[model samples]
Target chain A: MTDMVMYEEEYRQIQEVCARLHRDANASAVLLIDKNGQLISEAGDTGHLDTTSLSSLTAGNVAATGGIASLLKEKEFTGQFHEGEQINVHISIVAQRVILVILFDERSSLGLVRLRVRRASDELSSVFDSLLAKVQQPSTPSIFSEITDEDIDNLFKD
Target chain B: MSFINYSSREINCKIVYYGPGLCGKTTNLQYIYARTNPDAKGKMISLATETERTLFFDFLPLSLGEIRGFKTRFHLYTVPGQVFYDASRKLILKGVDGVVFVADSQIERTEANIESFDNLEHNLYEQGYDLAKIPYVVQYNKRDLPNVAPIAELRDLINPEQVPEFEAVATTGYGVFDTLKAVAKLVLTELKRGR
Candidate 1:
């Protein structure tokens, strides 16, 4: 698979989608993560959470689920839900490239979060499509292409 | 695959530690986690069995400073090294940017080392990655053990590609940072080459 490159335009668009989902779903927090476990963006009350660990574990969960799906000869389990005592989590894959997660308390119901995520997933997919197109264009300069050997060595210097 | 977030000024890469059961893959990560500064590292998560063997994987997120203006973040993972955990191993190899094969250095475990090495290549091939193309390094761990094989013998069997290799005793942290730095350097260099 080719590298996933995120430009400023797409980033802002993703952030907007996540923010809207957070408000509409009444989620305690909303997180968008790459399949590789990188946190792309987050919204709402995440200050108390360990979002980095959450993103990594969520990606692992999706990957393991995808593995089980393949074993059963199914396509993939595109969405999953977990009900907790005080919090509920709704996770869905967006465009097969990123994971969209919604964490809601009693303030929201699973039905509302799922409904809101369907629209947000569509918007996020389209934004990612444009981002992929931009990434594939030969005219788009890669940041790595300009990095020098000295620059790489500098990272290991201390 | 690496993820470059220009908007966030960060580059995220995944590096996996792979080897046979009890080959010290988790120990390598544990040592790194113990040594890293709080500000530069996140919580190290280990999903393991009740017996303490890795069940799925061990994940540690680290910030290896910056290059130019972009922060370089690495998500380090260790696969469940037991032979029966092949399915879990395959899952962890997904989207790996680099690999470190931590071979058990004891002579008795030679076959297991070779088998795990072949498994790494086979799993990567199934995922469309060629062993030769990826930034990879090898570590002959358990070097402090009395029954360990010679480095030269281990190299002949495991380092046919002549990839950067190190002798490590993961428990005491010997050669740990060297192995980490060598692989991380190769990974960054690979990134610089835009692959």
Candidate 2:
């Protein structure tokens, strides 16, 4: 797998899409996580949630479901929903690289969330396409390129 | 695969702990979680059976301070090490930036260690990551046990690549951070080289 490098331009674009989706779907929260369980960006009421754990667990759930799909000779199982008394979670994979999660309660219905996510997923995927191109440019130097061995050692220094 | 977010000035990498059953993979993560400052770590999540054996994986997200202006974060995961959990192991290894193979060092567990090592290599190969190319380390755990094998013997058996290896009693936290720091450093060094 190639490293995922996000630039400011694409990040802003992604943030816009998430924000719009959150508003349009009337969702309580929205999160975009990489398949490796890294939180890329999040929107809505996330301050009270432990997003780190949520991202990791959601990725694990996706990975496990993907495994099950392969066993059945399918490419992947891209969408999952978990309903609860007070909340509901809608999860889907975008461009096979990142997960899109929308959490809603009585304020939003499943149909509305799914409809808004379908549009947001396409927008996010296009943003990622451009981001990937930017990352692949050889002229773009890595931030770590200037780091010295001393820097790494100092991190371990107590 | 590492994720670098310029907007957030954050760098996140995934490191997986792999080994055979009851080999202390989970224990190693537990020690780190308990010892880390609350601000530097998120909640530790263990997807385990009622008996506490890991049903899927254990996850711990840690922030290892900063490198340059970028905040360095690592999501550590421990796969269920039981022999029957091969599918779960492979799933956890996906997108891994580094690996720590926790070997059960007890003499009778020698064969299990080798089998698990081979499994690690095979699973990595399936994902197109060469065992030699990836940032990897070995930890011989259960060193406090009286029946444990010699470190030299264990190294020769599982670590022919001469990768950094540590001796540890995970329950007591010996060599735990040493092993973590070694692999984390290797991962960052590899990232630098990739550029």
Candidate 3:
């Protein structure tokens, strides 16, 4: 968690892509939720944003659907898309460890967001892979594997 | 699969549940744990906030019915649903082999359901997975609820891809086994196909 293990530049690139997506999709917000459903980076904001609840919902989304995907026993999965009336969100897994979420209004077309997000995801993956390599090689504690049982317990310390 | 030791004859697979909050995602896991024989399942851990909401992730290791010579072992994970928890969710999704989507069968929850569903795809892509190629299934939970959407409507709205879909009242254990069976079967089928 020190200064964020992921490089700031990588996130800036994600933000740039997200901002452009927001303009193109005309959506209210674009967010990046990790595999654990933690919001990493976001763009665009409107009134209907609830950070906590939405994060939980998104994580639950990945868990439940991903479970089924495994059950079907087909192959690995890429991502899922949910379309709504006033609000349409597109979520994609970027670096196998990061989730890329984009929220837009009816003005956002699924086609445009899907296309741009795909390109951005490749760049995002390289950045993350590099960052992960740095973390692994340096022998530092990443937010992922570094937390000790004590740390986890302290999270619940009253 | 390299992360797992197959030489030990244990077929370990990472199965993740993906859905929106309050979509019975945890409930589905709970039902699976509750119904499983004590010897077949291991520790069920939930890393949640004081409010009882999942903070980072929840993990449970299960040993399902074995096959041929391999023991079917699965590591089940539930990611934190809050929006800010993307970092944690991505970590949990690493090296996943299968996914289950729990769609709340309520009309009003359509937006949340879709958002959560789309998030699943995004995460999988990062893991180098193809959603269509993955062993996937859909569970329409909360069927006992008053305002729950009909199964047909839920099917039409959520899973137009026509994968293995089931109606689950995860709380009462209805269709829970069906969901598990579908996914496990698919997982094993995939393993066999590779053979």
| CA RMSD of each candidate after superposition | 0.8, 0.7, 16.7
Q: Give the lDDT of residue A127 in candidate 3.
A: 68
Q: Write the per-residue lDDT of candidate 3 for residues A63-82, one digit (tens) a residue.
A: 65665666699454667888
TM-score (2 decimals) of chain A in model 1:
0.98
- Chain B of candidate 1 achieves a TM-score of 0.98
Among all windows of ten consecutive residues in candidate 3 chain B, which has the lowest summed lDDT?
A: B1-10
How good is the docking of model 3, by CAPRI class? incorrect
lDDT tens per residue, model 3, B110-159: 88888887788898787677788878899888888889877777777678
Give the lDDT of residue A22 in candidate 3: 65
Model 1 residue B41 lDDT score: 98
Better of 2 and 3 by TM-score: 2
Model 3 regions more than 4 Å off:
A1-158, B1-6
Q: Which stretches of candidate 2 lie over 4 Å from their true place?
A: none
lDDT of each: 0.94, 0.94, 0.68
Candidate 2 lDDT tens digits, B1-195: 999999999989899999999999999999999999999999999999999999999999999988898999999999998889999999999999999999999999999999999999999999999999999999999988999999899999999999999999999999999999999999999999889
lDDT of 1 by residue, A59-117 (tens): 99999999999999999999999999999999999999899999999999999999999
As a TM-score, model 2 comes out at 0.99
